[model samples]
Target: MLNKTIAIIGAGNMGTSLIRGILNAQLTSAKKIYASGTRMEKLEKLKTEFGVHITTNNKDAAKRVDIVVLCVKAAVIRKVLEEMHDVLHKDQFIISIAAGVTTESMEKIVGKNIPIVRSMPNIASTVGLGSTAISFGKYVHEKQHDIAIKIFEAVGDVVVVGEQHLDAVTGLSGSGPAYIYMVIEALIDGGVKMGLPRDISTKLAIQTVLGSAKLVKESNVHPAILRDQVTTPGGTTINAIHELESHGLRSMLIDAVATATIRSRELSELINK
Candidate 1:
């Protein structure tokens, strides 16, 4: 849907995953995608693997692309922007994947009239299945929003959320994959304790977790109902569930989300300050 050249200013895990997705989706040709990093070795690795242009100059990357992706950590956003500020064109859209960095702060660096987008995407982008939320700044035109959506959607699902909710999205989805991984690991441990082989236990645990999520997606029924179907009264499932409740499983999950939300808010305040 687009022919505009794109440049990514970081070659880390998320950045590399985004590159893979963009190519797999055929959103742009390899020749049009550029990956940039300060490390020559990393840039060389991306160049060898993707056959795309790689560079160590952030300014050069910004100067040559229509859409510039800022994939660095939140703490590093200001530094990266300052380095590329002189070369950033007025027409370029700066799409930031840094958690907790707001569009308002980004605008201050790029000029309030320059287009900017702040987005949060989970790690699932590596496999072409991720959930992302984005907020647009004042200078982001309708066309720019469309382009931002296209770029994020190439990796996974994309939603445009109000700026106020970006932090909540970060807590809920950005950091959620790790929580899910913990649950999967605990389930595998349980299987292993039951005498199942470690590898088999882990495989079953992972697939079951994934399948359960797919069922929720494909079935219109409320999760509670689907859960109830498997949890017949006085059945083995209910017994296990009772044991979980005895150990405060549900409350622990709620506390986990709450803690993550509070921490995200703190980080946002720190960055904004």
Candidate 2:
């Protein structure tokens, strides 16, 4: 444990997720964790639920902390940084979870000398199953980078990526959850249409997605290899595969990811302006 005081600048869903993760990892004691936000009730809820320090002033949150997590939305990061800039020290580190917000942009708002770590983490972090991609700023230290990785890894898998790849991570994992969610909804609908009970269909669809993901991780084989293994010369799986292919399912899914990637890159340009 680093034993450093950490402050979270927003108490929203992602902020709460990190708080839960930090508490679960026991990375820092409750007294060392501080949270601030504009919503009084939300901060109260977090204070009561987790027993951490809570406030509404961003600078108050920034003062006396070794590291700060910028959980605010992408649009308002600059405003918040401006609010806290006077109180921010060069020695302190910052970790940001806002999508499409680059480290260089943050440094422009905060200070070029401050250590900043930019990350993209999905909503799954609430359940400790998220995937996070991180990139370093110009002034970040290796020790701070390790600490940021530990903070993210407490919730799920962590990837150290080049700054240029962050937007792709935002496209793939950041918006990817909604894509899988749509697939699950369609699966459940198909099961229900086939006369299965709604509850059972939902459960089956969820488990199928989970199990397939586990297989991809544990089998250590290419997905095509596994696909060939399941395709008997004249099998039911092949028939379904043929139907899906005929309907252009694979191409549509590929296009969806590509579209999301393009949008993520576009957002970067917008944020830069």
Candidate 3:
């Protein structure tokens, strides 16, 4: 829980999810959090549901908080920053979750002296199982960095990385959930093809992925070693593994991440331009 007030400048999905996560984690009282957005009905709904202060003016929200969270889209982040620039103080911390919007670009909009932390959090944040990667700007101090970590930690896991590596983080964790979803869908289809009912296959596939992930986290062993443990001479698991290998699954996944990283860099360049 942070003692300082937080202002979320956008009431979009990620912003709303953070509000819910912070409240659910008891990291901060609703009274200390303020949300701003364009839609009156949405702001009113958030105020009613979360018991937090809500406003349509971004500058007003920024002026009243100790930390400002930029949750707007990459296309609008510059506009929001310009709107709040006059109200933002050097002492206040800024955390941005807009994909491809770098801290350097935000510094240009706000000020060179303002502390900024840029982060990438996946859609799983809504489910409290997100993986977030954070990077600090030149003006950010140790305490402000810790606060940024606490804010995201309320929703899920947090990892610190260099700003230069954020594009790679964006490629891996930020886009990884969609890849996992595709795999899960394929697994469910495979089960169904083997005569299992659709609903049963869905449950089995989801649970298998979830349980396997949990195992990897808890075992603290190499995944390949774990896979070897499940494989036996002339066995079903080995045959399945062989099939995946024959299909070039490993190389495909590697290429997917690499391609996503390249695209992330291109998007960042576009935003910075």
Candidate 4:
């Protein structure tokens, strides 16, 4: 928890979620938060819901906060930084959730050796279960890193990783929730094919996924071992596993992560260029 004022430069889903998470966890009070966005309607809604200061001026948001979170899109990170660079100072810490925008790129735009943190947090952050991986800029100190961790912990778990691994993190956890959603949909459809009602199938599939993930987390067991436990010598689950393996399910997921990583690298290269 922190007492310092914080600014979120883009009041979109992630930014809104951070405000909610911070308030829910009592990391900071509502009045200490400032959110900015292009859409007045959305910003007004956020103000009504979270009771935080709202603005259309990014520089105003940056001017007084001890920390500034850049939740804008990667393509607009440079523009946002350039717009607020005059108001930004070294004493303030910067955290950017814009995918593929490195701290080095941000530092270049700011032209100051500011404490910048690059974080990749998945969409699950909206529900306060996000898995976030963070890397630091050249000037970040231990105190700054601890503050960053506490801020992210309000939403979900946090991990410190080398900058080199961030692209892979972007591909895996950053894009992983979508993959799991697709899998859940497929599971629901499979239940429907087997004659279960649509609504019933949906609930069952969702709970099954949720319970399984919780088990893995709480039991601290290897996933393969858990699968083996669920699979008897000749059980229905084993049959399903065979079908999935035969259809290259595992390989498909692997390829998906790899492809995403490659694209992340390409996007980062574009921004750096």
Candidate 5:
């Protein structure tokens, strides 16, 4: 068990999900976790459901915790950092989950002395299956880095990357869930077009996607190899693959990730400015 107090500074969907994961994993006791937010109803709900301490004062939460997770939106991260600056100390670690908020930018607001970690966790985290990318600031120690990893691992898989590569991570895993959801929807629509009921199509599409991902992960085979294995000469699968290739499905997905990466970089620049 982690013997430290952690405070989540924004009790939104992501923050609440983390809290549930942390407690369920027994990384730390619920009493050691504090949640702060502006909405009284949300704060009280968290308190009642999780038995965590709740407060509206951000500084109070920051002052008492060994680790602070800033889950506020990117637009409000600077303001929250400024509010907690005086209470945040060198010994404490800060982790930010705000998309496009870099560790460098947070350091400027909180001062360079504080250790900071910036992470990108996709919406899948709500279901304890997130893919999170972590990047450490210059001041973070090895132990602090491990702590950040453990916290995120409770909710999903975690990867460590250089700060410079976090934008790419944001483009891929950070924004990947929506892309996958679209694919699932399209597959369901295709199933319906073939005369399947809507509900059955939805169920089949969801399970097929889930099982295919599991197969790729467990079999440790390249997805292309797996695709070839499924496709026989003049088979239905090959025909479907041909249609997808003709429609530029692969190219479109690649372009989508690239565009998202550029947008992430643009947001970072704007935040830093």
Candidate 6:
């Protein structure tokens, strides 16, 4: 168990998801978690549901925590930082889930050389299968880094990368769920085209994607090699693979990631400005 008090500054979807993930994983006790937000009713509901402390005052929530998680919107991160500035000490750690908000911008606002972590967690976090990548500021120590990793690992997998590479992470895993959803949708439609009912098609497509991913993860095998394993010289799977290759599927996915990365950079520029 992580023996620390954590305050989630926003009681929104991502914040709530992280809170649930933490509690479900038994990382920390509910009483040690403080949730703050603008809506009293929602906060009260959360308090009843999770038995966590809930408050409307951001500073109050922030002042008494080992780690403060910034789960607020990207547009208001600066404002929230300023609001919590006086309360945040160097000993306290910061982990922001706000997309495109760089640690530098956070450092500039906090002005304490505090350890701030910029994290990108996709919407899959809502389901406890999130893919989160964390980038640290200059002041983070080894212990603090481990704490950050442990906190995120409650929700799902966590990877560490240079702060500069976060945009690509944002483009890939951060926005990857939607891309995969599209693929699943297409697969379901294809199954329907082949005379399968919509519901059955949906389930089959979802399981196929999930099982394939599980196989790749468990076997530690390259996807191309795995693809070859399912394919024969003159088989239906090869015929399907030929269609996907002919349609420039790989190239399109590459372009999609690159475009998303560039857009992430542009959004960061706008936010940091």
What's the CA RMSD for each of the models? 1.1, 1.1, 1.0, 0.8, 0.9, 1.0
Relative to the true structure, candidate 1 has a C-alpha RMSD (angstroms) of 1.1
lDDT score for residue 246 of model 3: 100
Residue-wise lDDT of candidate 5 within 1-273, one digit each (tens)? 897899999989999999998998899999899899999898999999999999999999999999999999999998898998888999999999998888888888988489999999988988899999999999999999899999999999999999888888888999999999999999999999999999999999999999999999899999999999999999999999999999999999999999999999998898888
- How high a TM-score does candidate 3 get? 0.98
After superposing candidate 4, which stretches have Cα over 4 Å from the reference? Answer: none
Off by over 4 Å in 5: none
lDDT of 6: 0.93
For candidate 3, lDDT tens digit of each residue in 126-204?
9999999999999999998888898899889999999999899988999999999999999999999999999999999
The lDDT, on a scale of 0 to 1, for candidate 3 is 0.93
Q: Write the per-residue lDDT of candidate 6 for residues 1-273, one digit (tens) a residue.
A: 887899999989999999999999888899999999999999999999999999999999999999999999998898889999999999998999999999999999999988998999999888888999998998899998888898888888999999999999989999999999999999999999999999999999999999999899999999999999999899999999899999999999999999999999999999999
What is candidate 1's CA lDDT for residue 58?
Answer: 86
lDDT for model 1 comes to 0.89
Residue pairs clashing in model 1 are: none
Candidate 6 lands at a TM-score of: 0.98
Could you tell me which 10 consecutive residues in candidate 1 have the lowest summed lDDT?
109-118
Clash statistics: count for each candidate? 0, 0, 1, 0, 0, 0
TM-score of each model, in listed order: 0.97, 0.97, 0.98, 0.98, 0.98, 0.98
lDDT of each: 0.89, 0.91, 0.93, 0.94, 0.93, 0.93
Ranking 1 against 4 by lDDT, winner: 4
Q: How big is the positional error of residue 123 in model 2, measured in Å on the Cα after superposition?
A: 1.1
| Model 1 error, position 65 (Å) | 0.7
Q: lDDT tens digits, residues 3-103, model 4?
A: 88999999898998889998999988999999999999999999899899999999999997999999999989999999999989999999999999889
